[model samples]
Target: MPAEKKAYPLRISATVLEAMQRWSDDELRSVNAQIEYVLREALRKSGRLKAGMAKPMVDDKPDT
Candidate 1:
């Protein structure tokens, strides 16, 4: 099953919001998507996300 998402309120300065908006536009992603992507990357870099976590296989053939 796909993971569920939770919504939370955020408070930030207009300067930060504007910067994020510009970055999100450049990345071709919604502001929320960019935020999530950035947070996930930060977590991974900080070792908060396990490196050995499961990853899907690339093969497309049906199981025999």
Candidate 2:
């Protein structure tokens, strides 16, 4: 089964939001999905999220 999602309110600067909107548009993902993808990647890089804990949007190979 997939993990349940939780909703949380976010307050962001207009400039940052605009950038995110543009990036999300280019990536063909919703703003929410873009934010989640970034956060997930950061967590994984920092060793907070295990590779097996969450399914990646793409095949992520470790740095050589």
Candidate 3:
């Protein structure tokens, strides 16, 4: 079975949102996924991604 999706609320700058939308479009990912990717990368860079924690899988399809 496929994994269920979860919703998160976040606040970002207008420029950041615009950049994310572009990035997500280029990468064939949703805006939310792009944001999550950036957040996870930041967390990992700061040594916050635990070995035992599951990684996220973003769907290629955008929100309906």
Q: Which residue runs of candidate 3 sit more than 4 Å off their true CA positions? A: 1-6, 52-54, 61-64
Best by lDDT: 2
Over the stretch 30-52, how does candidate 3's per-residue lDDT look in tens digits? 88877877777788778888743
Tens digit of per-residue lDDT, candidate 2, span 10-63: 999999999999988777777888888888989989999999865655432334
lDDT per model vs. reference: 0.67, 0.79, 0.76
Error of 3 at 1 (Å): 8.7
Provide the TM-score for each candidate, comma-separated. 0.75, 0.82, 0.69
Question: In candidate 2, which residue ranges exceed 4 Å CA deviation?
Answer: 56-64
Off by over 4 Å in 1: 52-64
Checking candidate 1 for backbone clashes, the offending pairs are none
The candidate scoring highest on TM-score is 2
What is the full ranking by lDDT, best candidate first? 2, 3, 1
Query: Native-vs-model 1 lDDT?
Result: 0.67
| lDDT score for residue 4 of model 3 | 77
Q: State the lDDT of candidate 1 residue by residue for 1-64, as single tens digits.
A: 6455678999989998899889987877667776776777777789887765322222222355
